[model samples]
Target: MAVSFVQRRFMSNALQKWAYNLSGFNKLGLMRDDCLYENDDVKEALRRLPQTVVDERNYRLIRAVQLSIQKDILPKEQWTKLEEDVMYLQPFLKEVKKEREEREAWNKQY
Candidate 1:
C-alpha cells in the first residue's frame, strides 16, 4: 500500500526518535513532532542512526517490497526497478542535510 502523508510523517518521526534514543542525543521536545519537514532535525537524527540500524531499515523496506511482489501487490517487472534507487538513501539524507542548512541560514537572515 502507498504510504499516506500521515503514515510517512509517523515513520519519519519514529525513525528520528529511534535514532536520537540510540545516539543519546538529549534535545528537549525533539521527539514529539510528527513533521519531517524540519530538515535539520531529520538530518541530525538520520546521522545518528547506527550504520547497522540504517542497513537493517533498508533491508526491511526492501523485504517489504519483495513481499508485496510475492503477494502480487506489485508487478514482478518492477521488482528490480528500485534497486538503483535504493542506493539513493545516502544521497537523500545528504540532500536533507543541505536543505536543513539552507533553512537554518534563511532563518538566520530574517
Candidate 2:
C-alpha cells in the first residue's frame, strides 16, 4: 500500500510538472502562482503582503512582460522550476476567503 501511494504521488507530481512546463509561463521566468489573475481575493492578498514581497512580485511581473514583448524567454537556468515555485499569495487569499465566509455566515440570520 505504501509503495503504491508513493508511486501515485510521484506520478501526480510528474504530471503536474509536465502541465506546468506545457503552460509556457515558466519560460518567461514566471511561476504558476505569478500567472494567476488578479481578482479581488488576489488584490487583497497583495495588499496584505510585505513591501519586499510586493516589490519582488512587481519585478517578476515587469521582467515577464519585458521578456514577452521581446519574444524571448529567460535563460534555461533562470526558468521557474516547479519544485521551487511557492504560492506566496495563496495564504493571504485563503485568509480573505475565510473572512468572507465568516461574514456570510454571520449575515445568515434567517
Candidate 3:
C-alpha cells in the first residue's frame, strides 16, 4: 500500500512538472503565478503588493509580451524552473479573500 502511494505521489509530481514545462509560458520567462487570470481578487492582491514586487512583475509581463510579439522564447536556461516558481501573490490573495469574506459576513449580520 505504501509503495503504491509513493509511486502515485512520484507520478503526480512528474505529471505536474511535465505539464508545467509544456505550458510554454515559462519559455517566455514568466512564472506560473504570472499567468494567472487577473480577476477582482487578483487585482486587489496586486494592488496590495509592494512597489518593488509589482515592478518586477510588470517587467516580466512586458518582456513576455515583447517576446511573444517577436515570436521568440527566452533561452532554455532563462526559463522559469519549477523549483524557482514561488507563489508570490498567494498570501496577499488569501488575505484579500479572507477580508472580503469577513466583510460579507459582517454585512449579513447587520
Candidate 4:
C-alpha cells in the first residue's frame, strides 16, 4: 500500500511538472499561481498579501506583459521552476473564503 502511494505521488508530481512546462507561462517568468484567473477571491487574497510580496507579484506581471508585447520569453535560466512556484496567495484565499462562508451562514441564521 505504501509503495502504491509513493508511486502515485511520483506520477502526480511528474504530471504536474509536464503540465506546468506545457502551460508556457513560466517562459514569461511567471509562477503557476501568477497565472490563476483574477476573480473576486484572488483579488481579495492579493489585497491581503504583504507589500513586498504584492510588489514582487506586480513586478513579475509587468515584466511578463512587456515580454509578451515584444513577442519574447525570458532567458531559459530565468524561467520560474516548478519547485519554486509557491502558492503564495493560498493562505489568504483560504482565510477570505472561510470568512465569507461564515458571513453567509450568519446571514442565513438571521
Q: Pick the candidate with the highest lDDT.
A: 3
Report clashes for each candidate as comma-separated counts. 0, 0, 0, 0
Task: Write one digit per residue (lDDT tens) for candidate 2, span 4-103.
Answer: 9889999999999899889888888777668888898888888999999889878999999998889989998998998888888889889999998898
Worst 10 residues of 1 by lDDT: 24-33
| Residue 49 lDDT in candidate 3 | 96
lDDT (10s digit) by residue, model 1, range 1-110: 89899999989878865665453212211111222354655656667667985676556456555665666333434333212223324555677668788999999999
> Mind sharing the TM-score for model 2?
0.86
Cα lDDT of candidate 3 equals 0.93
Estimate the TM-score of every prediction: 0.30, 0.86, 0.89, 0.87
The predicted structure with the larger TM-score, 2 or 4, is: 4
Regarding TM-score, does 1 or 4 come out ahead? Answer: 4
- lDDT by candidate, in order shown: 0.51, 0.87, 0.93, 0.91
**Evaluated with TM-score, which candidate comes out highest?**
3
lDDT of 4 by residue, 1-110 (tens): 25798899999999998998899999998986788799988899999899999999999999999999999998999999899989998899999999999999999999
lDDT of 1: 0.51
Output the lDDT of residue 106, model 4. 100
Cα shift from native, residue 73, model 3 (Å): 0.9
